[model samples]
Target: MELKKKPTKKDNFVFLFKGSPLNDFLYPFKKAANQWVARYIIVTFAIIIRCAVGLGSYSGENQPPNFGDFEYNRHYMEIVTSLPLYQWYLQDLGNSNFMLKFPPLYAYHSFIWGIIGKLINKSWFELNNSIGCQDIDLKSFMRITVLFSELIAYIPSVIIYTRWMGRHYNKAPSIDQTIIAATILFLPDLAIIDHGHFQYNSFLLGIALIALNNLLYDNLALASIFFTLSICFNPMILYYSPIFFFYLLSLCFVPKFNLIRLIYIGVSVLLTFIVIFLPFIYSGGIQLLSHILYTTFPLNFNILHQSYPNFWSMTNHLLNNNIDLSNLKNLSIILTILAISPSCYAIFTNTSKRLLPWCLASCSLSFFLFSFLIDETSVLLPWMPVTLLLNEVDADVISMICWFFNTCLFSLMPLLKKDGLLLQYFVLGVLSNWLMGNLSWVRKFVNIIIPFISQRPNATPVLPHSYSWTATIISFYVTATIILSCDLLQIQPLVEIENFWEISNTFLSTISFGIFYVWLNFKIYTIHSLKAKSD
Candidate 1:
């Protein structure tokens, strides 16, 4: 018979996970408080962090000619709340210039929130007077909206999903589920973008999470409905639609395929679209709806979204900015389809719930990497699936995700800095790192100053001693340092160049994201091959 060694108190400190040392320092508190208390504590901490970040400047603090996304969102609310249903998307006044570019569901959501905003302060939605509004009460109201959305929708969705997955798979303990849920809620990019940068991303993401939760429960019809709702709220969620399409279609091929379920899902989706769009059709006819569709998926912009880190962005920069990919829109669409096809195929072939998140990440990342005219904020999309994998998975996977999280933050450095969010970035980054046990590596540097705190072995080493891995780690760190130095020192551009720091950051981010893209593709291919061999 095999003998098992007894777990020491130190091992008990890592009880949130079995035989894992991640966040060992937090174990004492976990032990002291019950699971519910610990979960609430983490949720409260996440909310507090968001509220703290809300104090920073928003997208366009005082800019006049045309403000940034903050002003655009305010305009959206004003139109949705004050304008007639048909006229909401067609508002062309100077102050109402942003108009309702999003789908009708999001417009209705904004309408409700705008009513609340009006209740708080009448001037907030007072048509032209609300233009470029930046009062403290307005800011507070906006922040509260995001927080409330997250609290009511996103946080609960993630927690329920994680707990459901844990129970279904029996993969890890309850504490691990709570930790994963909390960590997903505490992701810095989501908090920074939604709360600090000012948007309704968490709400959209929450709806998507609920869709995935329904999928986990094998409630395919509800999953389809929830996903339809998500896409209506933010059409960008369609980036993952291809994989979902194949996955759901594959389900129809399973044994004893239920025609009733299929019809139910189809009707649910059709009714949803009808309910949201029928009013618009009644008010303004198909032409107004066509115009709304045109604005939602605008194609006039150039390939790069102001040097966003993507394939076209880097390619254009490398070719001395002479290549006009705007002329190759058809080719761009073709390549994006090609890039995402493999992952969709994998998901279709696998059709396993365990592989869903990975396949989702793969497809969404392919879109982010190869699709035309993606923004930095869209990083949160791929991150949603990746973040869902932060349970007691492989340590290497966890470490890779940690690095990717940091890369996502670094990629948005220029945007974050422009919005005066540097402090939030630094503080939240450190806190998230500490929470994930990524800061254990800091003990090595800390031991150089204070020796006692460094004795515990790192649960996840920052870098392996292998040549390729070490080189990659060192190069990434060096690149990050250079980018930070360039930003902090306000490096002046050469005579021929403008915003050189931004350009460099964009280039580096593109390279890092490209590496990750390759890794994801490789993972998808490997999983498919292994499964094929097993079959």
Candidate 2:
């Protein structure tokens, strides 16, 4: 027999026996702390760039220099210990104005942030809502608050990402995972909330991803709570119930299981369903989930109508009267059909190891297909990229596409916008927002808030001084370089990138990234296959 290499210190980890109770308890915490310390750069970068995108760029008020957090922040105050949750939730004013009230999950999240924000400024509410730059510049407070809150938000997700990385077969630690975690954890759309119109998705999205992971691992109770919480925030997750249900079916019927596994699966499903349905059930005391929640599937916000309150509406409104909802329905079906091609194959043929990736890919395709022909609901498209990133799997072309798009965004946005192409930016935002703002109600508020806040903040007038074409050129090049470096990473695709030219540039980069990723995947697969045969 060929000599087996001795286990090295590099491969030794706290989680070599992580399944044990002592190890599980210690490792997840230790891994979390380590990842927290090690991932400082990625996390910091994720927070700061997103902050600049808000502070340096503009807030939803597009108030050139304004970055207000909420409309009635004064009433509820920022998340602080002084206020009671009941008081925060029971508030009457900020609800519909910002659409923060409807989604139960996000309202709760805002409760937490409001408490923290209140503690920070004591009158951050006044600073945010009232028309005056407080003891600090609107820009500085705007940037600092977003950066600080987001940093606070990351505490839980780093824990989750560390657990995920530690779960890999070799129990390896990856900087790649840290980087991807940072991207998901510091979603620019949510991070920009303080900079513009942020709601509760920032930290909660991580919880959603964790819930998804737990569901696949057959941890139903926690997953159900998370999924429910996620849905409470965005409500669009209710659409994903079909995915979850089908997954439950596969777990129950498709997989052959031992008695314990079967018991585990059964309890997981029952507990998850009960937990997810718990809130509505308590309200009605016997609310029919099939009628109240499931019936609202394929939610119709005039999705077929071009004027259908899409992400692109603020930038430019279009009237496409000829289409019907049936058309959107048909289109989503066709797109779903397209998505199933590779995804179904991967799921059925790939080994158990591929389940997470397959599920994510399928969900992403369903979302994408829905966006493509569903009139103007396309703003939800960027979520496809974000959701796919959580899968933590990539191929050559996909990686290249991600990188190329990122490069194109910074390099391309100003050039195209300067040339009278707000439409292109709208499409990008539509897709980005759609993907990132997977929660519909959250998306709706942002759709209104960003533009609503576009005017100058009356309190402190910072004139709208976008980079002059010259300044833009210099700044954009620097931005493009940083983006290019990440593109080289290609952990997530460039749907997050800004404009058409950027997308085109990203497409070009994808061509290169695809080649490299393919080679790498091939090398790994070949080695694995050989090793398997040898064994």
Candidate 3:
């Protein structure tokens, strides 16, 4: 027999060299050029929306003051700017005694805006005192100020996140990647509008993301400093700091020397503490830290007067006239430690099977799980996993979970607060119980008979990665488009209980929750099945 057509030594060497992935450049890094364009479109739209709201009437000339009225925002802005530390750098807050009225950061920003208004017009006193008046002509500008600050701060986070995520895995983000990034940007429903027309969180959230990204990559000092700076803007972001500390502690046993990294971590913590405490060190720095930490972590339930009534807070309210937190300082610490311990242990042991995405996911989930059950906080939940969950290209599981959650959130847009009841609860009765709020017979009938024929009124997940018609036509995307269209067209909601989509909203929420449960369970089972097969 003739000799087999085997490769020569040179052929084998060239083939082996070419096959190595060591020198390959990550495509996502190159995709940065495209990322920038997409990023612009996303931010520009957000900015324009903010500008519109900023210009829109906060108080209805004819419509009565309701949940999201201009008065609510204006009053809050005034209160925020009145805080002692807010305008410490300026003399205006000093003269006006703004310290007693608002939080430090709130006053600080007001001073800056006041200065701008005065510069553009005639007098500082007139501008500052009458900032919201049409005569001052500053309300529109202030609105723009509040909105742009948030939008601008939030945009840069994607850059670092994209790079770190892309480099770790060395790939361009897929379509799912863009969706995930977009989701993170759009997660907080109220945050967007609140920051858009009346408030600010972009600065704090942006700083928090920077700190987290750095800490994840082992740049502890930079991370700590970034965190400290973020705290100065909004104190509510520190609930997840334990996760970072635990991350640092874990590096102590990296199986290889990382002494420089350890130094960086120590420096980071020290710098953060200094930044946070420098102003109040004389007043009582440690006390300030403890107080801020307690108040900031997950935020106090009552900060927003219309807080989502949770089991704890609602129960507390019933037992007393109000929810008493007189004994909560230590309780909160204990709760946080207990809640975050699993992640800490996993991080320290370097034994977490789900560190990267799970880190963000765990915190995001914890915020939702442990907070006072507000609808607004639900927005932040998806970003945790969506951005960091790029370990495998076929992330069908993650995508499905995100899709369901998006549905639940989108469905909730129409219902916020009305009278004594959260509007969504009533909607649940309608959609889940066929528009019946009280008739048990009808509810029972719907449950017993409808289940056999119709699909449950559930938050349905988008299909997995295949290019099926269903996958391409994301229901949440469709729903969102319709809702946006309705808002633009000033069309009333569909199938209203009173006159709009009533029970259907609640039905969609239930469906979303159901789909998320199923999709998560499926992922858990698939991973286990694969592991079992491999073993």
Candidate 4:
């Protein structure tokens, strides 16, 4: 027999990762040139998937009386373009069906897109007649606008972020970078909401991601500008405001009091807001600004929860009749403040760059879980920061990231179902889990059920501990099964409750979210301690 050669360090390293999920997934792109090609292919595939999803049924497709948000978006565009600048918000306030509730930057965005629509087909955006216009060309034009927004803002941000992280944080290969980008791009919630359900959420999130990318590079001034612009586009970004404020404030005193840096960031933020609101300010002054602010923030105590799978939503059934709305709203505010305090304090004291994403995740999760006036789609806000942590080296962190994403997607099922997106939901969910190497147990279970279906012989478990992963997998399937069975089978509630299944879904999701919130805060504190020790 021939003597076996001694294994080199590189050989051992390669062997160590031979059957690892990332390695297996990237096996095709083993060469640098192939990795480059794979990156472009992945991006192209993502855009194609997005475009395909856009072709599906949107919110309120042919629904009469009061149509859904797609119609609201179209209406906003028409009003912004047709009416004078000063009348935009005023007109929206008067029109109950279509409220221009977003910030002025959104109004500006609507105006730009509206102008494009006018160019494409003048009658589609005609003054009063365009309110409920269901023209095929208009639908295509609107969907294309959302797609273009993703290409211009969201896709580029993810690419730049993953490239930077691959180079610096993990020193990962280009294939790994491409995989990360794919994971973010293929997120089911965003695709469903933006493409299937019809919204420009990706555009706002893209600006926020650019701000986060700036934070990674210590570009404080630019980060401030982009973050302010993101908030101007949608006040929903305020969910992340506390963490940003605490982290950036801590930077001012780190090593020494950097007054100049603070002023620079402040001025950058102020100038950005001023520029975005300049037209409204010039036309209608403080009165217009106040109206915009009120409409945007509208602390309406009337409805405690609107299909949000959060703490308030879970308890709304029991509390709605028992408690006063105003008091309940105040209690929610207090709970949210308490929930976010620890993460903010940790970042304020630690101020490490690595801790920023965790802090952001924690803060946004707190907002989603406890803040009042939340919509189900608001889950995407917290999910955004968690996406940044996918490339973390720790297995537990990776598992938690997967768990968090699943919960976010699960929470939006009711809304997606209402929009007639069940098919897209299931398709995207399976594709995302496969791409991220999650839910391997489910695949194995399916393989066992059908002997002819082949399984990956060397597939790595997402979590090293199979028992914990199994429990999570079972929980997800069970909850999903119960919810779908009730809805699809039209099962009556055992208890005589209206919307029993919806309430149960909200409650179950809130429990998962609550557990995740605790786990994430614990992780943040652990990170702070580790950084302290390293220092």
Question: On residues 1-535, what C-alpha lDDT tens digit does candidate 2 reach at each position?
Answer: 9999986533433222222222222234334645556466555555555654543333223332322343333233342134343333333333333212335444444456555565666555552244323434444544554456445544455545455644653344553344335435444334433334333334444556656667646576666567666666555544344455455444555546446645665575466556545665665544444444433333544443332222222112223234444566566567555544433433333334334433443444344334333322222223323333332332222333233234323333433333333343444434432332222334335657675533321110011123342343334346555554554465345635544233444333333323323333343345345645765
Candidate 1 colliding pairs? none
**What global local distance difference test value does model 2 have?**
0.42
lDDT (C-alpha, whole model) for all candidates: 0.77, 0.42, 0.46, 0.80
- What value of lDDT does candidate 1 attain over all alpha carbons? 0.77
Which candidate leads the pack in lDDT?
4
Ranking by lDDT: 4, 1, 3, 2
By TM-score, the better pick of 2 and 3 is 3
- Misplaced by over 4 Å in model 3 are 1-35, 52-110, 121-137, 173-191, 195-197, 256-263, 276-338, 351-354, 371-395, 403-535
Cα lDDT of model 4 by residue, 1-535, tens digit: 9999996543432332334454565668867664667667777888888888887888888897568889888988888988899988887534576878889888888999999999989998777776778888888999999989888888889888888877786666666677777777877889889999998889998999899889889999999999999999988899889988887898998778999999998999999999998899899999998989998776773445465687776676667545566577788889999999999999899987677788888899898888875675888888888988866656567766777777778778888888888888889887777766665557678877897575564333455465865586568768777777877787776335677667777887888878778878888889899988989
Q: How many residue pairs clash in each candidate?
A: 0, 37, 21, 0
Instruction: Tell me the lDDT of model 1 at 64.
Output: 86
Which regions in candidate 1 have their CA more than 4 angstroms from the true location? 5-34, 95-97, 255-258, 445-454, 464-467, 491-497, 530-535
**Model 1 lDDT tens row, 192-289:** 99888888889998998888888888888888888988888888888778877888877876555768767887887898888878898999999988
* Native-structure RMSD, model 3: 12.0
Better of 1 and 4 by TM-score: 1
As for model 2, its CA RMSD to the true structure in angstroms is 15.2
